[model samples]
Target: MELVFATHNRNKFKEIEAMLPDHISLLSLDDIGCTEDIAETADTIDGNAILKAEYVRHRYGYNCFADDTGLEVDALAGAPGVYSARYAGDQKDDKANVAKLLEQLKDKESRKAHFKTVIALNLKNNENLFTGICEGKIIEERRGEKGFGYDPVFVPNGYDRTFAEMEMKEKAEISHRGKAFKALIDYLSK
Candidate 1:
């Protein structure tokens, strides 16, 4: 009744852990004897997620999962699909990535975009993949001071505040990760 979340981000682990039921104990790379920094070079979220899940499950022999997310903009034709994390350059700084995104869309008008999250689950004897998307638009300026990543600049559909402006519970109720995790839980139940 335990699973490993094949990611290095403590924040993401916490978020996912919050959604998991008590019967399912969620562990991470730190829990195993692994510390290697694997490269996420896959062109799509699904590919990258599978890579991580398979890698961790192969090495640790545990029912594990990995999640990869991307921000796709209709106007930019998904300029930073796979490279969303390192959009600015080699440094995966969140602020730098946001700055680069804002600069690129400064003069553009169509700010429509969507945040997509893909989760790849690998059991010792089976595999599963799930995807979820949250539609939103990029604002000209950043708003609020909560949340992380693209939360400050991207406002969800039918809302005036950015993800950063919403409480953690609020965001969890209507976030790309939330949607994807909900789908994953549903799949697990069946």
Candidate 2:
């Protein structure tokens, strides 16, 4: 089953492709000659995911899936929820986003946070949504250098190491996006 994953970010494409089974072939925007940047103008993660998926399907007439992830902090009242990608600016600088998040979380004790992912799949005019969450707390400073996008600052629940500190396989086992894609696979298999 070949499905286009509506994203220009190579990192996201790689991560998701690694998660998908061998029978499923994943294609990125680049793979299908879609150099255009799909706008994510929605106010919510779910909406943004849907928008991306719908955009690809409408323009290219392909079965596609798109995902939006957010880092919701209890201390900030879920700030940066829908703007995780552009939290620092529109450039989507991962380092700058992490810096801003750490600055906002400074001097706060509650540090409770969670990473949430919403995936929207457009298959033959039928759209489906799946969600996943990984609960954890924010560290005072960045820890490791493996993963991207606030991975250095987030320590998943029941784990001592941050996402950046974990291996790719380990992170995949517990990441919000991983869980969401797993659900997507289950839905597709059914």
Error of 2 at 174 (Å): 0.6
User: Would you list the clashing residue pairs of candidate 1?
Assistant: none
Q: Relative to the unseen true structure, what is the Cα RMSD of model 1?
A: 1.0
Model 2 pairs whose backbones collide: none
* Per-residue lDDT of model 1, residues 8-60, tens digit only: 88878888888887777888888886798767978898999999999988877
TM-score of 2: 0.98
Query: Which runs in model 2 stand beyond 4 Å of their true positions?
Result: none
On residues 1-190, what C-alpha lDDT tens digit does candidate 2 reach at each position?
9999998888788888888888899999998999988888999999999999999999999999999999999999998899998999999999999999999988888999999999999998899999999999999999998989989999999999999999888898899999999999999988
Q: Could you say which candidate leads in TM-score?
A: 2
Measured by TM-score, how close is model 1 to the native structure?
0.96
Estimate the TM-score of every prediction.
Answer: 0.96, 0.98
> Alpha carbon lDDT of residue 13, candidate 2?
86
lDDT of 1 at 70: 93
Error of 2 at 15 (Å): 1.2
